[model samples]
Target: MRTQQFSRTARSLVAAACALTCLAAEAAAIKIQSRDPAGFGFNDPTPAAPVGGNTGTTLGEQRMNVYRYVADIWEKNLDSDVEIVVSAGWEPLACTATSATLGSAAAWNVWRDFENGKPGTWYPQALANKLAGENLSNGQPDDGTGYGNVDIKTQFNINLGQPNCLAGSGFYLGLDGNAGDAVNFAATLLHELGHGLGFSVVSVQTSTGYRLNASATAYSPTGLPSIWEGFMYDNTARKSWLEMTATERRQSAINPLQLAWTGPNAVAGAAITLAPLPVVKATSPAGAVPTTPYTASSFGPAVPRSGKLGVLATITAQAGELGPGCSPFDAANAAAVRGKVPIINRGGCTFAEKVKNAQNAGAVGVVLANNVAGSFAPGGADPTVTIPSVGVLQEDGERLKAAVAAAKAYGSRTQPGAVTASFAIDPNRKAGADLAGRPLLYTPNPLIGGSSVSHWDVSAVPNLLMEPNISDDLTLSVSPPKDLTLPLLKDLGW
Candidate 1:
């Protein structure tokens, strides 16, 4: 989807030095053990050891802060009540400490393995054993038992050595080189923890030894079988549930899900949802001579002159063509409502420009159809453009074009200079109405009230990278242990 990039105001604050030891009690909530005895590592500590004869700022405390923040966000989002333990001693089992003598290239290689592919041949087994030991000791499932005993590990190889990583991760946030930017360490940690809590790619073994995978799915612990099973079957059906969870979490942070514009920290009011443009149908015979003129009301649903629905309008355009609203008004079709909806050829200019031109022409809505054979881009609408819009298949546009040509040959001359077209709106389309500048309201829920949890402030660490737009980027994997009843499957068919 095309998203509008907007500049946001920057906020700054001087970070007060506080002893890391002071947070030890809080860290215990996440099962994180602190190496700093006096918490001096954060507030005041001995000078760091020199690297290449240069000393770098100690990041131990900042790293711990990130852990705390992640735990807090997770606690807030999860439906179940569970305690999260963030510990410094829990070394990333997937990564190995590199020797000081290794060059940057070698260090990067070590990091790259963690991000793209599975762990080394020895690592998974060893890690599984370690986790099994921990679980068994805690009276949980041991290795080769239930799915819960399985340890699935994936790496996020963020390049901390690069400035982009720092900026993207929101670690080195402010102009003064201080922390506390809106996209701060805490936010990054929250995102990463999202991955840890079943928000990454997942697969399940099937009875036929095949695997089913869906690019996107919802998160559900109940759907997933125990980890002890080997080899996923029918993986094609797997969906990324993690992505949905992340989106919900991010939305919750920025705005309330129930109330569109009522987010505690929303930058704008509730957004408007516009409908798709009406299509024009042909009324004449094929290959007939042009004899009629197009009129403004020839298309589907007349533009509402008043009332709530009147606040929005839609105009369809040919695939890879300019939208009806964006196309320049054609004098040859003077009576035609060309400017009302500019239907230019598609697949050239960006959707942003198309929507911009339509908005410029006093159009409140626009639609772009595909010119070629392909699915519309997911989330195709530009995020920056608040106006409601959608895309149609190229075949559908061609059919409409044929209908218009037939109408012209039928001598249905309403006007020589007028343009008229109409098409039906799909009844099953997702329902959303446009209401700009409106307030969204929701009732209070007594079952779950407001509460706060640990908040960690993360910092850049050497050779690690954090995912961007954590809200929508993460994905989850889930599968049923056995074939579900046909009735159940049909009832939940998506």
Candidate 2:
């Protein structure tokens, strides 16, 4: 992450001007340059059947096509004279039976103080090139180790969905949005490219909240801010990142829902892109509990706005860690949980498994309590799990537990409707946006490296392309009326 600062140096400006003059007059194009070696990665010779509007006949060709398609989408939405080059490849990134790094990308380099750029703000290489009206990169071939002529460097998981590598979930090369159980390759590309184009900040250490210095060699308390930080508003601190100290910025990064994107375009985009967040509200407990936010499970039917009203109960495990509710509840536990919404601890099993067991135990609805702090929309699909389910943060779950215990101690479960609650969408609050219609950034406590403070909050309805997680519901659209990515880019002066 080098931040090359431009000056009034005639030599540099003339070089840039010469590069721009050499290009043919045409709309800016995003070029996908393969960085893979022969017989592997993007060069793999494996045969592949065309599917979902993708006509490539080989594995590598299909992967390349997805990249090109994503690039074309960005090119169509953006205006620039200099062509943006993305160096992309495939590699065996981290993978497991449950999770995998489908892909990752970042700006190859950053620039500041360039022509038509904000002073003291670092712009990503591609965006910098657009603003400067010239190609500023070294224009060297990439070997997957360092930055060069490329504006963005990206790589995907080659062994994905193979044995021992997220075994059952691989990349779907289809141009159509029907990814089914596999990850959508084009959607992932769109997301990574957004980061490269300008969606991410160049924080040397997010925990310290330090941006790269002018030279970009290291982090500093007085370092230049990334253009992305200009829109990072901390509602709790009542200040934007541009107005905060490093210490204050660090605190705001972990403030969860407190950090929001204050860009006007994003704010307007959120109004149409996001829906009201679904939450669990305890009406009987009233003043005893706060309205709790939840992430709806992708597997079940959408949580109804009408709400599911029931007594909240906890399931007991015959044997397990913290009663995760991995296995079916026994007869006694079933009776206790029957006709109620059971709050099951996360982990020990898939969300679908837990919900299916709760449904079998006669649960009308379910709440999957986070085993850890923070919240995420629970993934996986199970057609048989008919009851709706939502996820609550660990602390929120604790609050619910305490409320239930208090109510239970005071009154009988059947008599006064103890622990009575309803899980439903709250029309007052947008899912991933603040009350002011600004979209919340992913600012989890304890800081999720590469995720926190960079991507959109996962609670976003319809799932924006810039969210940390690649959702199954994302479309190719990156502009307004359907998506917020292009709007946000426009905010960054795209």
Candidate 3:
């Protein structure tokens, strides 16, 4: 989508740091420009009882209250003199019985060559105006969309939580952090707003690896970079996105765990907020692998450091089973897996389903092997899955299968087991970060549009508010020690 273009109005502004310092002296004013018609979106008149520190008596009023509340949080964290306007509304976005698009937001415009902006680098409209100390969004004719004066554009799903539309997962518009089974509307809003305010790539296409031209209306071979790209460092290319070519940036987008944010503020915040990563340590069967990093499943209990070690049992397909362990194990397979940790292949069922099957079979823990070649974090909610579960790379799974087969063939594999493993935390390395402690950006093998390079990697411990998926345990805080959103904004010159 093209960012709305505006004719830049001349303004005298100080240098970058001094401009930011001057703006940081006062609180910002965030204005929500309602895009919906009357009696709709923020104007709906449906009656609603007060709940969770929100006093609005109508549905739309409650929604607006949450918007203003989240806006106040960002306003306090950001510094600006000109009113930061966000064009927002509620609409029927994409939804299904189990999943839905909660909302989407991005900069309504991008600017470059401004008084305080880095030369040839794009800045989001709101931040651009703040740095330049003038409203560049004004004095533009409505290109028929009525978004000429807006700095950001956002929308949410109005039909969320309804039947057939992510049924039972509607937005909970409460100030309290008790979302229960419902989605926390406040946290979701805060995350999307973070993107609009500056936590997003302005005009780079992940699929094609092409950057947007100065006008941002089409892809260009020689395109200007955004301020966000200045911090993206690719270990494979040994260069930052600012120093790499378009093809190199495209290749780095799928480099997985090699693409990291180099922003000092965010890197520092990660040291405070992130924890050591969880891994599987093969402790038995001499010559077994030492340590293998794994992605913890969202469905099961966290992998503990000790007390759960056992033989690494490999599952065989049984009669009536979908795949390896897609269904309940038979007598023989269950017996072999009993009191052991079963390594199941991914597919034919949900991660929760496989882990639940393992738990029911008396397994101490579960290791999920990827069907594909790259890394992935499994996500699903299952309270019955009490066992610790983690996913390993495809190559690791193949090695485990070979080792199990070879060991079981020999008599020495009987007593202490062919392979024994347990989960452990590598205190030397941080979760979701590189060796230097820089937080990894989301860069899966196949690109996920709007999620691939724009958000933090999902493996982050403590579950950041901007990690593509929303965790129910998120709080209102957006600064360091609790979150890294504000620090990243600071890196973007907020």
Candidate 4:
């Protein structure tokens, strides 16, 4: 995290260029180089007509679509009036040239090798050379050009990899429609481009000063200290503008680091649509004798003593600390006494096994909490399991455990006992409903109806290996947008 400032010599050079350019009256140009190889899948067949329909859209078109999506968000949210100029061909040049070397496969390969081994290592000389190839900027061998430029390069590469692009960042996007498909291109691109647009700021914080590194910046978006994390954890504090509190003010503020793009009165733009979760209905007999006594301390108030409550019974198997084998008359029995909610510890077997066990015993609902210390944020329930279940924290589990202990200490005198409990389920709880209508928003779970976060939820993993529950997978990581702001509307003439 070394902070490298622009050198005096570079400043002098820029001054000289400005003086010379004044006489020529030349405008500084923002160039976009679109590299489309012949016969590549991204090329449009007609070239003249707008690319539409499934077949006519090429790989490049998909990538462009993603860019448009991002641009739309930036314009509506950030109010940036910048114009984008797109150029497509074999190779297009943009700026200053500092290196003498032309194109060389060996050079590209060597650079790739160095980059792959350690993604974060910054080589000023190599970067200056690479920039020379693109004519973006100029630098000397020992001048310490730094990574601000490298951040831009990494962003460009990510854009190229659009759909089936490469895993990390090295693999170039292929026009071969066979390798990369257009599925999820819009969301994935928006997420990655977010990295390109100053989302990396959260990674380097200061006790006193800023931490700097090109890789740190490049890796920032998909990494943590994410805007989403900040908003979720700091909801009450208003520390992040992305939360509901700052939603209106975000649009007027120009700073990219602020949470919301506009203030509370501003529109949140289109809401991010999500898929729906699967529905599971309760199915069990309607009446059974109480295996345990009913009490408010033993079960929640929602549980009923008769009807759907007592008729349903669920059986489960507990292993590890609770000991192994199935328990037919344990937690499920407690739930049946009141007719609807059963609590179980999470360990020993798969969620499917636990659900099947409960189903066999005729229970209608299940609540499973972590057996370990801390919160029960272990992950999600198995998607295939049909029973509706939610997780409780370890503290809740401990409360039940303590009640059981007290019941044993009291002997059999206590009717229904302190350990009595019931099962309860809700069929219509929607995911992300907490912040669904707000300007700044996020989904806590990946699958709409499923219980966990999917690999595709974030933009860092290899596109090919993405799957549901990838958030729990150690291989994947998430990068969140940092403080994002839009300048005062008047400044941008809107």
Candidate 5:
């Protein structure tokens, strides 16, 4: 990613001249030129204007407008003067009979038409070289570097099954909010544009961490290193892309708190109110309060609840209740479980089964103790559970368990501390820059490929419009105070 440093006075002048929303006139309005008009397959050549837009426009025309809307947003804010090459037409992007991919975008002509001297192949990191101005001989016309020479491919799925915007029917084609009537193409297209603009890495992810697909043995000139690597930081390992192990880097892709984007442009003009994560505070009778971080259970209701959790000394194992806590379970001590949070180990069966057993024994909530080191969302299915649940670090679990034992041995008064804890959503405040002044690229757990490291965490507060999954209840936006993506583009020398 590149950085475009501006003077404080210059910024102040722009802020003064334009509303916080945007500049009165774009510094440079990047054009969106269409490709292969015949491929779009529209008869009229002109599509309708979208909902609330020019009413009499054609569907094909309406589709182009949405693409342009996304392009306009990028053109208005990005520091680039180059035109974005866009192709918006219908194609059956079906992976199956009923499902299809919505769209995709990427840096173009940044790769060699051939791989490793092959006549027609390209490595993934080739784009990084172009972004870095390495100008590697990729068998394509040199477009210089430090900026994109083409538009991000904002393709759509015009599959046969859905009355969706991409299909030119079910979605509201305008740049306005939908009343649950249609899909919001503007939001979806913006996300794709974000990727094309460098909100992605070409590193290959594995079951563990990520590895560079291409070897980098040089620095400059030959374009040995990928510039995108400089931005990825793993807080868990307290290391950047260069310092992490393959497994460490892979985990960073999903380790919400660990993964971050440390680029000058990303955090530029930074003002964040990060949504805090829930803190499990254990108040002792001694008036001491100790808090620990936790991961919410994947299954069960999202209701955040706080109260005392009763611990059962019995630990369960995986394999659908193979160990203790099985039916006819002696672990279901009514005295220990009735109406209280059931704190138990995460093992012996599915999380759903474990919670089901707890609920059957009168558990008001469930607190799972992690057997692994770092915390992750507890995975299991329990659709009928109405109570909230959470997972704590093993260390924290041990302490909480011991406290329960102490409470059992002696009365509440003699236990020395309050045994209650609170489990609820902790909307974080924005993650400020680390010591190096690099901002974070937060993507929450249950990590997905293609989506990881490419977008903000889904749970991020103040609404991260770039999360992998586009919410139906979204409106298009691209500035800070509500979004951080535009600044990232500027940092990449957009």
Candidate 6:
């Protein structure tokens, strides 16, 4: 829930293009058409036309150019034939949503059938209407496969409670990165368009996710009812799409920070990465600094040791926490661990599993002292978790564990302990650990709207463009740092 401030400087850079053209020779090129929502007052900014996503303050041609830029990035890289209709307009910002939001999007008449020989797929109906670019004159070809025929619709935000449409906020809407307190419009466009391409889940989830909404005349490769619920993956439940129960699927969307995208295109796109150097630190309750252990959480925002941090108490007993190496860590222990970092032993399960349990139980951050040896990078693959987590050295872990045991014998969730400490980000560390040379998406325990089960997770070397909220320092290019949105488009059956 931390809001990005206005400070970073923008670096002028061209969107590094990618090899995203559709595979089939007959596949029509991706057509991106922009429109002003009918009857809605929409004003173009200043600076008119430009070369990339950012267009300064100028509206009209400039803003449209940025929209075209986003379309160009996707159109050129995606291997599909379909039209995306975009609607730009102004709307009141809800007190609950991000004020900087540029807009929102949704796929129209959507349906899915395995395209790359995979199961539980979701594709636009317009794309599924034809094969490659083959003629659809004979009643708009019905041979199920590839992209569809109808156009996908989207709405962009021209006003976030602002009167003068061109008045700049702490956001840069040009081809450049954040320029003296500005958000990149190009990058924002990319994120919103990605959602329209089916990077979103149902806000009100049902047993089968939201209905496919495709007409009876629409394509349904599986004859089964189509829904966004059919494409989700729950690691904690180890269930993919239809395999999950209604509850599991709904929970997946709620805790997006910990979920994974199984769509071939999403997985493939997620294969992308950027160089990372996040500065995060976790000192023990005793004030002693631990070893070089670090983490790349896909959930909570990264903070520097030089900045403000979460709880620093030594973890004694937990509440509702469970796992092989876990003990009485649950709600009953909230009084002792509330708002404090809980130190827990590792092993018997994944690093993510332990943190998820601890975080959901009300722990702000978790210091997972390794049950085994040398420091290794920590990981996050679920949505329920939203706290900072780290893997301290074995010795360091034991020190915290010992301190807890001495203060309050036998990990009892109800007993308070004398373990009082603090934590901070490792300013010297700079960035986070490079995640296995690939980007991972975050699926939290309880999902965050719009951000649930989408975007690159913490493992990415440097923060990527599609990581929930776009980073100000992000570039205008379609390169990894500036362009993960297209890669995901490529993954979602392009």
lDDT of 2 by residue, 191-286 (tens): 988888878866546899787887778888998888888788899899999899999998988887778887777777777768877778885543
Best by lDDT: 3
Where model 3 places Cα greater than 4 Å from the true spot, the runs are 4-25, 318-324, 373-375, 409-416
Candidate 3, residues 79-184: lDDT per residue as tens digits?
8888998888999999899889999999888887777667767788999898888887677677788776688889999999999899988899889978888899
What lDDT is reached at residue 273 by model 4? Answer: 25
2 against 5, candidate with superior lDDT: 2
Q: lDDT tens string, model 4, 1-494?
A: 22222211111001011111122111222223444655542443434223332232455565454445444554444322232222223222221221111100000101111211123322122222222223222341322433222323222332232233332222212222222222233333333333333322222222211222333343322222221122222233354422322332222121111122222211121121211211222321222212221111111122232333322222244343232112434554545523344556667655445544554555555555555432222332344444444444445544544444444444455433333344432223211222332222212211132111111221111111122221211211121111112211111111
lDDT of 1 by residue, 1-494 (tens): 00011112312211222221221121112333443335343322434443222234444444444445445533433322223322232221222221111001000000001211122111121112222222212344334422222222222222332343332332331222133222333434443443333321122221111222221132232222212111111111222222223333222222211221211111011121212223232233444222211111111233332222111123444344444434543333222322443343345556556656655555544445556532232122243554434344455555545444444444446632222433334222211111222122111111111110001001000001221222221112111111111111111110
RMSD of each: 19.2, 5.1, 3.1, 16.1, 9.1, 13.3
Pitting candidate 4 against candidate 5, the one with the higher TM-score is 5
Error of 3 at 242 (Å): 1.7
By lDDT, highest first, what's the ranking?
3, 2, 5, 6, 4, 1
TM-score versus the correct structure, for each prediction = 0.34, 0.89, 0.92, 0.38, 0.61, 0.54
Task: Please list the C-alpha lDDT of all candidates, in the order they appear.
Answer: 0.27, 0.79, 0.82, 0.29, 0.53, 0.48
Q: At residue 406, what lDDT does model 1 achieve?
A: 46
Off by over 4 Å in 5: 1-25, 30-59, 94-101, 111-149, 160-174, 179-183, 203-223, 242-256, 268-271, 276-278, 284-419, 423-439, 442-447, 472-475
lDDT for model 5 comes to 0.53
Give lDDT: candidate 4, residue 285: 25
Candidate 3: residue 65 Cα off by (Å): 0.9
Candidate 2 regions exceeding 4 Å error are: 9-27, 138-147, 285-290, 316-319, 330-332, 371-373, 409-416
lDDT of 6 at 374: 35
Which residue runs of candidate 6 sit more than 4 Å off their true CA positions?
1-34, 37-58, 81-101, 112-122, 126-150, 161-171, 201-232, 255-258, 262-440, 458-461, 477-484
Tell me how candidate 1 scores on lDDT.
0.27
Please count the clashing residue pairs in each candidate, in the order shown: 83, 1, 0, 51, 47, 95
